[model samples]
Target: MSFLFFTAVGLLAATLGSLVGLGGGIIIVPALIYLGPYFIGKEVSVATAVGTSLAVLIFTAFSSTWSFHKQRKVDFRSGWLYFLTCGPGAMLGSFLTQFVDATTFQLAFGIFMLIMALLLIFKGYLKPVNVRWAIQRTYTDDHGAVHTYGYGALPALAIGLVVGIISGLFGVGGGSLFVPAMMLLFRYPPHVATATSMFVIFLSSIMGTVTHVALGEVDVWMVLGLAPSALVGGWIGARIASSLSSGKLLWVLRITFFLVAVRMIWEGLG
Candidate 1:
């Protein structure tokens, strides 16, 4: 029954996460922290919840990345660039977790989520000045549609570094930040950003998961219970997202972030 319950939650989390390019950590981490107690009749520590969530993300991120790759929506060039910095950042973040207690981690996650929510809500009015750098390139999607975009390499590298660290620290896939940065800062289309984010997340999650496992933070049984469902859910969600308009996708992301923020804040306060 416990396995079934967590599997169901994983399914839902993966579906929503893939649709919005979040990689499902935001949903899975909180669900496990707040709801696991009810199912297990004991409190689950924040580190355990995060570690388990990262483990599950390994499967979901791969599933989502494969789905997007099939549609040729993923921008390999941009994704690789982000992955380079994200990998190191994730490693550092995982190590840093040794210093963070449950209360501190919970509060930090809540505050970070709240800040991200506000950023998403006011993204339109907070646009940075457009600047072109030497990394200009044109990408063609599976549909033969071409997108030309450019961004400062240094700025992108910095963003990737920060995002990777955050992902490792929070056991998230970092899509929430990566997608927005790609769209707002790099001028990538929403669909392209979402696809590329999944790839970047897949890379970051690999390193983060390994680090968490070494730290003995992951719940192996829970990961086994949730992995299969998360894979299926991610595939289904990516397909659905591919059919939706960019505007609709952004709305879904915005709402999810806001709701997650509220929940995290409430839990942190409690």
Candidate 2:
């Protein structure tokens, strides 16, 4: 029964995550917390549940990233830049959790998820991108040619900081925040932003999981059990996403975010 539940969670999260570029951690973490103890009793601790979820995320992100890469939507340049800050920030955030209680941490995580969901709901109806204080930067790529581009670095930095911290503390991909920040605040195309966000999260999750493992919080068996299901689900989702138009997909995702957000809030409060 526990095996079935874990597998179901992995498949569901991976499918939605691959299409939207989010690992569905908002759903995964809460489900584990509420349902795990019911079946496993003392065997599955809260730390173990969170850690295992992060580990499963590695497979989920990898599968989705492959799909995005095949479509040529992934922006490696932006991904590497974001990773530079998120990696170290995750390591730092992992240590900070020691000072807080478990209930407080979960409550904080739930609230943050709610805020991100609301932002997504509203941002979906806005323009393609917003760049109020854009800055121009020029850099040389691997081919030794210099290219110039404009973006808002200050807001990007701030977004990275907060997302990195939340990701480390909670096992989320931070897409709920990253996608919006890139599209609405930094003025990136929606597809480009989503793809880049996935690439960035792959790095953050690795660092965050490492810290969780070091603290003896990870459940190796649980992660191992979920990987296969998540991979398959991700592949299926990618195929579906490839067939849909951007406008339709955005509307579909908006409705999804609203439904999931309401459920999460209700679950957290109940």
**Reference-based TM-score of each model:** 0.91, 0.82
lDDT of 2 by residue, 19-102 (tens): 777776665776677777775454454566667777777788787788878876677876777787777776666656556555
Give, for candidate 1, the lowest lDDT window spanning 10 residues: 244-253
Candidate 1 Cα misplacement greater than 4 A, ranges? 124-129, 141-145, 246-256, 266-270
lDDT per residue, candidate 1, 1-270, as tens digits? 687778888898888778878888887887888888887566777778888888898899899999999987888987898888998898788778878987778778988877777776787676644767678877776578887777777888899999999998898888878887887777887777888888888898889889889999888988998899999989988998888644565566677767777766776678
| Candidate 1's TM-score | 0.91
Query: lDDT (CA) for every model shown?
Result: 0.83, 0.70
Clashes of each: 0, 0
Residue 107 CA error for candidate 1 (Å)?
1.4
